[model samples]
Target: MRPVSVRRTVTALVSALALASTAASPAAGAPRTIELVNLGDSFSAAFGTGGLQQVEGVDSCDQGTGRDHVDELGSHPRVEVTLDAACAGYTAQEVEDLVSTKPVREALATADVVTLTMGGNDIGWAEFIGTCSAAAEAESGPAPCDALLAQAPARIAAASSSAAETADAIGTESDARIVVLGYPNLFDDRQDSPLISAGRAAQLNDWTDELNAALAAAVAEEGAVFVDVTDRFRGHGVGSADPWILFAPEAGAHNLHPTERGYLCGYFPGLLSQVARTR
Candidate 1:
């Protein structure tokens, strides 16, 4: 879970902020604070990162008051937050739960921004991981990995489309900058590549690509922001670029999940910047 940084594609923040110019801002007397509502699965939830502190059954990440985005983005802001409601292995349906169960007034009543990363679990990412791994191991066959990946394009489209609808609905009601984050490399490509093939890496990455792309497209169509972190996570595994995740079989590994280091290195940077953008 310790990483400096991976080979990032570096989509600059200036360009990302320019995309959000139509949202509402806080009232003049209200503190110029960025109230972030992270409604997603584990990644944005700050799970395993020990960054969240729950109060009265309500979860909130450290926003550093006027520096919530600054603490995360390493800069200053009027106010920032690290709201967390991300559950492990969340799906499209679970998103409704995230919003419905929360104290809406506390979390979304004055929400300036919202970030989500869903639909992978909806498409059965865990199943895809196991299946794709097995298929990659059985490389002697007619490329079962290819067949499994074939389903990704359609599944991602359906799941993302549904997710986009939900985001739009919430955004309209709360006037928040709804940002969607894409998944990273969970599978090791070496498994089928004869180099390392740790489990079902290649096929899984390919499928991940499909899901990520679909998510980006959906966010765009929904008029929400898209925060892609796919390429940055490639070297998270053992002997990886930055080793953000512990190769499995180890105890309590955040495998298939973003490591704390990954969070500091890439996730938080890309995310906080988008959340702090002015409308």
Candidate 2:
């Protein structure tokens, strides 16, 4: 998979650029007045995949519709979607700025389902990367990826705690399904590939496992649902007819953001499952 950490880094950068140009408002008079708010980083912000424009009647944003996840539903739990808000390099703390801060007032207010794929880019993955990178330098070539992979769970746990505060906020409001969408498998978990290095794939997958566990715990504590995307994305692992993986030349394809096919198959399929579970 060309190393998931590296790919996610590229996805983070492009996601930031996309977030800078988009804004989220409210969707009105749709089915059941179900307000769907997507608040998170670039993975949730699909950006120029459709480009920016104004959300009608709200008179606040000009961002396009592509960044919205509820729209990705197609028919699953169908509702009117708001492109909502996405902040690139957005930490757990930054989520408040969009939903509660002075800049965007209605970004996350009174919604039926609020979904996000966040925190990995904000946590200490870079430090893990540095550790892996240094290990590689010392061992020569790709050996450091092993060390980096081992340390992923602890890092994600810490990050999820910080992100959990957002779940807490949603709990306070009682307006939406506080769904925390997790990052998918980013590595092969197998050591036979040249594209990934050493035990690097396993390490990344291990970290993702740890992170998902932490997320599940955090969500349960907050009375929310933590949707596990691991198995689903893994099913689409490289070479599957419905691959959720990012390959080459797809812009941030090297990163963890869903491929267009991944979106159609992975995000939607798994997301629909999550919606069904809650309903």
Candidate 3:
């Protein structure tokens, strides 16, 4: 995998420092308890987006970052950030593993709302993208790209299964309103990079589209709310002049997670909208 970019690390720290003031504190009166529990992968964990709250001893896992949409949700006056069980590089199965733990389960038990954004890693996005890059280099036919697209369906099915199972597990633990967020398209237009062919970008977007569809269906099956952030992130994708999502950052976090702007403009609004309804 690629290292986190220097640009990303600096951006994250600055954004996180700015957003730190938004962290909600209990009001003077008897604290209006709005218990929010977050689960899933790096998106929810606020990895590269900055404002990272490193979990005390668990340096490896980004279970404590608070600058993503989850932080935005917690910014509401009454919301208490009881638990952010999300970790970078986690899949739906890994989320299930975290939820099954005693402390995390306890947090879920008191949760008023739970949000999940997972499955990209499970679908093997990096490997698929790698294949696409290779296909872009090929001077021959569609064989290389076709091989990657062919695997999408099975990948989607497996990921959907894991998502459904995770939803069920969360359901059993808390009566909190669940919201499963979708991934954003990485490119709003054709990439300017010589490394990525038009065909490759289209194929990758197709994979994202399929994954979002499967996730939506799974959330519906579990009677959970599905928040689609795809539209919000449209022109702000990776290839845009001012992309909301980060490309392969070389150090602190994963490659394709949202940027600080993505969380604030793309994810934060959608999630904050749900708070009133879920409550």
TM-scores, in order shown? Answer: 0.71, 0.69, 0.81
What is the Å distance of residue 13 in model 1 from its true position?
10
lDDT (0-100) at residue 216 of candidate 1?
Answer: 85
Q: Candidates 2 and 3: which is better by lDDT?
A: 3
What residue pairs clash in candidate 1, if any at all? Answer: 63-68, 66-78, 66-79, 68-80, 133-200, 188-201, 190-196, 190-197, 191-197
Top candidate when judged by lDDT against the true structure: 3
Q: When superposed on Cα atoms, how far off is each prediction in RMSD?
A: 6.3, 10.0, 6.6
| lDDT head-to-head 1 vs 3, winner | 3
Candidate 2 error regions (>4 Å): 1-31, 47-69, 74-78, 102-107, 126-153, 238-242, 249-254, 274-279
What would you estimate as the lDDT of candidate 2?
Answer: 0.56
Sort by lDDT, top down from the best: 3, 1, 2
CA lDDT of every candidate: 0.59, 0.56, 0.73
TM-score ranking, high to low: 3, 1, 2
Please write out the lDDT profile of model 3 over residues 1-279, one tens digit for every residue: 113553354345434433432333334544345688887887788865654555543335664343667775566556678887777778899888778878888888988888879888788887776666634557645676678789899999999889988998899988998989888887655655444665577778777988999998987898788888988888776667777777754634545668766777778767766655543
Per-residue error for 225 in candidate 2, Å, reads 0.7
User: What lDDT tens digits, residue by residue, belong to model 1 across residues 49-92?
Assistant: 43334334543422111112223442324435544555555676
Error of 3 at 167 (Å): 0.3
Mark the regions of model 1 whose C-alpha exceeds 4 Å error after superposition: 1-31, 47-77, 134-147, 188-200, 237-241
Q: Worst lDDT window (10 residues) for model 3?
A: 17-26
